[model samples]
Target: MSFTFFTPGPAQLYPTFEKHLQTFVSEQLGSISHRSQQYRDLHKFTVDQLRTLLNVPDSHAILFLGSASEAWERILFSCVELESFHLVNGSFSKKFYDCSNALNKYAHLFEKPMGESFVASEIVVPEYAELICTTHNETSSGVQMPVAEIHKLKQRNPGKFIAVDMVSSAPYPELDYSLIDTAFFSVQKAFGLPAGLGVWIVSEKCLQKAESIRNQYSIGAHNDLPTLWKNALNNETPATPNVMGIYLLGKIAEDFNKIGVQTLRKETEHKASLIYKFIEKQPGFSTFVKEKANRSQTVVVTNTEMPSADIIKHIKAKGMVVGSGYGKYKATQLRIANFPATSVEDVEKLIHELGSL
Candidate 1:
C-alpha cells in the first residue's frame, strides 16, 4: 500500500527533473557565488525560460527570491510606497494584507468570501494607493481569479502597480503579464520542487521607480529588488542563490520548453477535471468553492459530510494523503493537489478508497 494521493506542496517532481538533480549533485555543485558568472548564467536561463513560457513582456524584469513570501516583503519594502490596496478572498490573501499592515503601509482590502472572485468593480483606485496585490490562484480555497479582468483593472488605472501571487498558477501555462508590475510565485506548487525558490517578474516601470529611489534607502540582504535585478541579468542573485533548486529549475524549463506551456496547461486541466468528476460521484462530498469557473486547476478543495478529522484519519490509514482546509475552513474542507505528476488513475484510486471508507 503506497501512500499515493492528494499530497500538497511540495508537489511530486517529474522523473526527468529527479534524474537531472542526481547528476547535478554527483558533479559536486560548488558554492554559488552571488557575483560569479556560473551562478549568473543559471539565473539568466531561468528568467529567459519564464519569459518565453509565460508569454511575459520583454520589458518585465524577472528576479528570483528565496521564496514567494520574500517577494511579498521585497515588493512591500522596495516597490510600494505610501499605501496599497489588498484584495483578500482566502487565507493567503488575507495574511498578505496583514503583512502589509505589519510593515506600516496602509492597505485597503476588498474583502469577500473564500472562493469568490475579486471583481474589478471593487477597486476604487484611491490617489494615495501606489500598489495593488492579488493572488492569481488561491490554493487553500481552490479558487482562481480571472487574469483578464485583472488586466482590465490595470488598463483602467495606469499609475498603480499590479502585483499577483501566482504561486499555484505557474509551471502550467503562461499568465497574461502585460499590465502587472510584480508577479511572484513559489516553485514548490507548480514546479513540483522543494520550497527554496521564488520567482519574481517585474515590469520595466517597476525598475524605473526602484532606480529613482535607489539612493534614498539602504539595500537589505535579500529584499533589495534593484540590486537583485542587476545580479539576475548577469545570471546571479543578490545573496547566495539556491544552487540545487536553480539547477532543477533549468532542467524543468528545458523539459517545459520541449513539451510547451499550453500543452502542459491542458494536461493540468484534465487532471483537475478527473478529480472533480470523482468527487462528484461521492454521496456526501462536494467542491468547497461553489463556482465552477472559479475553481483552481492545480488544487481541488472539497467538503465531506463526515467530520474532517475522521476523514483525514481514514484517508491516511488507506494510504492516501490530502490537505486539511486552511484557517476557518479547517476540519471542513479537504484539499487535493492535481498538479502535473498527479494522474487520472490516482484520482480514481483515491475515490475508490474514499468510497470504501
Candidate 2:
C-alpha cells in the first residue's frame, strides 16, 4: 500500500514534486552542464526567488552546499577563528556544539534540559567568543527558540556574530535578516524536495570574517565562504551544481511565492494547533515541550505514555507514516512534521486517526 509521509525532514514531498520531476526531464535540466547558460539561468532564478520569498536583504550572499550538517562545519571553519558559544537544548543544537569541538575550536555552552530554552536576559557570552550558534527549531525535541529572543541576543552581543540553524523552521519564522549574521537549512526539510542540497544565507559581516581568515587556513576546498561569496555574485557555485534540485527548488518556491509566505505560515499554525489540541485532550499523551511558548510550529513532537510503536502501527495501517522520536527517545515519542508541503486536510485526517487510537 502507498503511504502518506508525516516523518520530519525528508518527510512529505511538496504537493507539486511529481510535476516538478516531469518538467526536470522534459526540459532536460539534468543534461545541462553547470557552465552552460541554461544552468546559469536556473541558478540565478532560484537565488532570486529565495531572496525575494524569504525577505533576504541585498547585503546577504546566498550559497548552496551539500546539507545543513555541512553548513555547520562551514560556519565554524569560515566564521569562527578561535572560540564559539552554543545554546544547546536538543540533538541538533548539541550537534552544532559538537561540530565546533570537532573542528578544535574552543566551544563553550549554556545548556538547558531537552525541552527548555535560553532566557535572553540571562545569557552570558564569553568575552573572546567570535560566534554564538543557536538552533531556531530543534527537530528532535520539537522546541523552538523565539526570534525576538535572538534579536535580543544580537542586541546584547553586537560585536559577535549570530548563526542560526533554521533547518526545519525556515521560510516560516519571518526572520528579520538584519538581526542575524548567518542562517542555513536543507531543502529536504521545509522546502520538500529530495535530499542533497543546503541553502546558506550569510550577511556582509560574515563574508568579512571569512575573508579575514582565508589567507591563514583552508576553510573548505569547494565550499570555502570567500569562494562561495565570489561565485554567488554571479548566481553560481564552485562545484558542479545540483541543477535539478536547484530547478525544482525554484519551481516550488515560485508556487509558495504565489500563495504568499504569510498565508502558508498561518496555515501551518492552524494545522499545528489541531494536533496540539488533540494531545491536550487525549489521554496518555503530552507535548514533549513543557511550555506552549516553546513548541515548534513546523515539527510537533508528542510524548506517549506507552511505547509509540502502537501509534505508529495504527497510523501506518491507515497508510500514513509518522516518525519515531530522535535518538534515545525513539520508543516513547512521535514526531509529526507540519511543513508548507503538508496539507491541512492531511493533518486533520492524521489527527482524526490519532484521536481514534
Candidate 3:
C-alpha cells in the first residue's frame, strides 16, 4: 500500500497552492528586478495581507528575509544590544542561544529539565538587556509555550524587548503580537510553501532599536538595518527576494483569512488530538512532554519503549516518515507534525497504518 506521513519542516503542499505557484512563476518568469514596481506591489500586498491576517498592529514594521534562520541572525545582529536573555526549552532553541553567545552577546540560558515544562520562575531577566527571546512552539520536543503567559510576563517587564521564533507556531492562533517586538517564521513549515522565504512581524520598537544600534556601530552590508527596513516597508528587499516563494505565501495568507485563524487553530487542535490519543493507547509509546496542556498543536514528540530506530524504520517502510530527536534526545524520541496542510484524514490514516507497524 502507498502511504505518506512525514512531518518535518517541509510537510506537504496544498494542491490549490501548487497550481497558483505555477501560474505565479509563469507570469513572472523573466522578472529579474525585485526593485521593480510589479515586485513592490506584490510585496506590499503580501505584508498588508499578513498584517491583517495575523492581527499585527499598525505601530509595527515587518520585513522578509531569504530564510527564517537569517531573520534570527538579523534580529540578533541588528536589534539586540550587547546582551540578551535566551530561554531554552528544546534543542533548536538552545542552538539559537548558542548563536547569540558566539556573537559575544551575554546569553543567560534557562534550560528546563527533560520531559518537563519550562516555567519562568527561575529565569532572572536582567533589567538592562536588549531583548528576551523564546520559541513559541519547539519542533524538537513538541512543547509549546502558552503565549498568553508570555504576554503577561511582557506586561511586567515593561522596558525589556521581546522576540519570538514562531517558525512552526504562526499557522495556529496564538500569534498575539501585542507584547512581542519581533516575531519571525519561515514559509516552508506551517505556511505550506516552499523554502527560501521568511516572514518577519516586526514591531516599531524593534525598528527603533535596530536604528540606534546601526547609528552607534558601523554596520555591515548584510546587517544594514535602515536599508532592510526601508526595502521591507516598500515591499521589496535590499537583496533579491525569493519572489516565487513569497507570492505563494501571500496567497496562503489570503486563504487563511478566508477561513480565519480561529478556525485553523481548531482544525489543528483536532488533528493533533487524534494523533496524541492514538499514541496514548499504544503500549510502547508515550508523549515526550507529559503535560497535555503544554503539548504543541503542530509537532508531537513521543517516547518509545521499543527501540526508536526500529520504530522509525517500521514506520518508514510503511511510507510514513517522522522526525528523530535533536541534540541529546536523538535515540529516545520520534516526532510527528500535524500542521495546516495535514488534514484530519491524514491523521486517521497514519494512526491506522502505524497499527500495522
Best by lDDT: 2
Q: Over the stretch 1-357, how does candidate 2's per-residue lDDT look in tens digits?
A: 978889897978998999989989998889988887788889999998999889999999889988889999999988898899999999999999999999899999999988787768999999999999999999989999988888899999999999999999988887788888999999998888999999999998888888888787667676888888898887778999788888999998988899998998899899999999999889988988988888999999999987999899999999999999988999999999988877888998998899888
Per-candidate Cα lDDT values, in order, are: 0.77, 0.90, 0.77
Q: For residues 63-160, write the lDDT of model 1, one tens digit per residue.
A: 77788887877787766666878888888888788878877778887888887876676677777888888887887788888777678788888788
Off by over 4 Å in 3: 1-3, 29-32, 218-220
Query: How many clashing residue pairs appear in each of the predictions shown?
Result: 3, 0, 0
Q: Candidate 3 residues 1-357, lDDT tens each?
A: 645545658777654687777788788634757878888888777887788888888877778787788777777776676887778877778878987877777877778865555555545787667778888888888888877757766776768888888897786746667777888888878877777887777777777777788766543477356788777767778877778877788888888888898898899889888889988998878888888778888888888777677878887786677777766777778888887887787778778876666
TM-score of each: 0.92, 0.98, 0.93
TM-score of 3: 0.93
Clashing pairs in 1: 39-235, 40-235, 40-236
lDDT of 1: 0.77
Worst 10 residues of 2 by lDDT: 213-222
Q: Distance from true position, residue 222, model 3, in Å?
A: 1.5
Best by TM-score: 2
Which of the predicted structures, 1 or 2, would earn the higher lDDT when compared with the native? 2
